[model samples]
Target: MTDLMETLIENREMVQPNHANMLESAHGGNVMKWMDEVGAMSAMRFSGETCVTARVNQMNFERPISVGDTAYITAYVYDAGESSVRVRLVTEREDLRTREREKTTESYFVYVAIDENNDPTSVPELTVSTDEGDRLRKKALDGERD
Candidate 1:
């Protein structure tokens, strides 16, 4: 089994003009792309194989992330099935100068591990070993109710 916290990963992207929408905020697609990328990374870390996106839960854009702000994406593997990994993704808008941050988006993604021939492969179970891992797992479980 793999420690759930060990699968955690974080990424940051600067919201440039090219990534912005007509409203001058980061585009929804761009944010989701980032989340998917990070979520795949976490899934791979847990599965130790090539992982492909299988499903994405409903995504909510809580707030707009303006251009020039930093987009912070955090992902972690919270559960695993025979060939699938469940990831929780959280996105926050960070003010570069002030260092302030606010939740901008959140979603859950499922990835299926694939073998060399591109067929589904089994993945180890995920384990929560520490207090932080327990808390994160609980939070992810609770977030689903919202």
Candidate 2:
């Protein structure tokens, strides 16, 4: 078993000019790519095997991340099946100068652990050992219910 908290992954990227769209904000594709990368990392951490993105649930871009702002991506495994791990991903825009943050996107990603032959393999059961881990799992579940 792997503790959910141990699988948590957080990544930050500075939105550069190349990563921005016409409006000088982070491009939706760029944000999605970042989310996928971090989500896979979290899944791999929990499964102890290479994972591939299987599905990405609805992704909503609620706000724009300015070109100069920092994009904060947080991902964690909330649940797992025999071979699949579900990760909750949240992206936020943070202004380093003001220390302000605003959520920009939210989505759930499913990854499947793979062996050296690229065949799906079973993943260990997930465990939540801390209050924070329990809260995160609940939040993901509640969001799905809503």
Candidate 3:
């Protein structure tokens, strides 16, 4: 079984000019890429297999991160299927000057682990402990739609 909290993963990106749009804020695609990468890592950690993105759902951009700031992306294994894992992703923007942080985007991503032959592979069961883990798992399940 997978320990959901211990299996959670995170990655950070420093917004650069290349990642920004004409408005000087990070491009949506760049942010999505970061989210996808971290979510994939979480899926890989849980399944112990290479994971590929199957779907990205309802990514809402609530704010923006400008160049020179840091964008923190977090992913956690909140739910699972026989072969697929659902990750809840959150992107936060950190201001370098005042050290403030705010949520910038959120989405749920689904990934399927594959064996060496690139076929779908089985994954371990997930276990949620603590209130935060349970709360997050419940929220992800509630927000998921097929």
Q: Summarize candidate 1's per-residue lDDT along 36-129 as a digit string, tens digits.
A: 9999999999999999999997799999999999999999998888999989999999998999999999998999999999999999989999
Which candidate comes out best when scored by lDDT? 2
Q: Model 2, 57: alpha-carbon shift in Å? A: 1.0
TM-score of each: 0.98, 0.98, 0.93
Per-residue lDDT tens digits for candidate 2, residues 1-146, read: 99999999999999999999999999999999999999999999999999999999889899999999999999999999999999999999999999899899999999999999999999999999899998999999887665
Q: How far is candidate 3 from the true structure (C-alpha RMSD, Å)?
A: 1.6
Score candidate 3 by lDDT.
0.90
- Which parts of model 2 have CA positions greater than 4 angstroms off? none
Q: List the lowest-lDDT window of 10 residues for candidate 2.
A: 137-146
The local distance difference test score of model 2 is: 0.95
- TM-score-best of 2 and 3: 2
